[model samples]
Target: MNISLKFKQVLNASLLKPLLASFFKPYCLLCVAYEGGELGLCKACLSDLPWHSAPQCPQCGLLSNGLICGSCLNLPPHFDATYSLFSYDFPLDSLMQHYKYRNMLPLASAFASLFHSYKLNGHAGIANIDLIIPMPMHRDRLKVRGFNQALELARLISKSTNINLDYSTCQRVKFTPPQASLPLKERIKNIRGAFSCQQNLHGKNIAIIDDVMTSGASLNELAKTLKEAGAAHVECWVIARTLAKSNY
Candidate 1:
């Protein structure tokens, strides 16, 4: 008997959801409301979250009304485009902090579902995408965190969108200081030589999945590594973006 992928996913979700709910009833983490929907957020709180509202530069993905940024014009990053789903602010930042630092692993599904909504609402550039690569956490960091949040997100996205994920073909070779902690001038240097790509992805367009895009230093470095490994196009699909020009 042959089973379809969608049917299997639905069956798995149907089976596991009840078992999960039996242990802990679903509730919104932000408001303690019993109104958590499919995305683990109530409609009110979900709408209130800082969604990215400004028009963005096609090349850099920064809010600039489609104008190319100077960085893209003068020294273009290896990535072809960046897609940030929400603005990094307020409760969103708090939620992200809790998810990454407080071990809120279940929130990955919420983030991925939110991205799917964005895609459905006419941001379906995902069709042009060929592969998904989550930003790698170095062995030391992975051991410390016990999980790579990006990879967790990539799994959900791959399942939802059916995009092929290549997690084993790249690695975080150098564990550098967190980009959020460094100044913009120092951020690039910190992430330099941090990633090593092993895949021979000639002519394929891939997106690196991450939770937040702050300075973009890490993503740019990873894109550089991927391009060197022969990926035709590299893009980013981040949950949030810090709109200001300063490093987060």
Candidate 2:
């Protein structure tokens, strides 16, 4: 690329883009009555969203008053910790459904922004991560979806944090029914032996990105695979976590 062209691209991204965006205010995705910010949500709507601020178990991201919950204590998941930004409810649930099923692509950027900013506050361990892996989808499912929502979110996060993102290193080998469709007892079995890691992640601390965590069976299985490949640590970083008895 020409030097001048490179400079122009940077200039547009750093200045011109924001300037143009400022002039054309976008309507809030939720209320639609107010002008939206970069998150596609107005201040009131954004503030009203269910943030996961309650004291909880750091392992499974479920509500727990103390350190590790009883479930994690009894049968620990392969992942060391979990960090979820929102409680999967109401408007958030609707927004996620739109993003994943309806292909609301811009929501990827909005979600990535949420994750990045949340981490920036005090997640010092994020800097220790060697790789960012988006929850891998089976090739068949990827084909039908046209794009992987997790991969899209991870791409923006990788760019912002300058972390190496590896989508290909781990893959969902078993093409099974959607975990959402299955019963709780069937979820772990459905996800069992689903992932395969191509590279040896020896001593690598990894963060896996996903849009929603329901049963957590999928993330647990993936973390197990990464640990088997010698990953030093694995953590789940999801946009939302279902709080009900439905899944995890």
Best by lDDT: 2
> Top TM-score: which candidate number?
2
Off by over 4 Å in 2: 1-24, 245-248
Measured against the true structure, the TM-scores of the candidates, in listed sequence, are 0.86, 0.88
For candidate 1, write residues 116-136 as lDDT tens digits.
Answer: 778434655778789999999
Clashes of each: 0, 0
Tens-digit per-residue lDDT, 1-248, candidate 2? 99999988886786687556655777777875547788787889888989998988888889888489888888889999999999999889999999999999988888889788875456878789889999999999989999999999999989989999999999899999999999888998889999999998999999999999998989999999999999999999999998764244
TM-score of 2: 0.88
lDDT score, candidate 1, position 201:
80
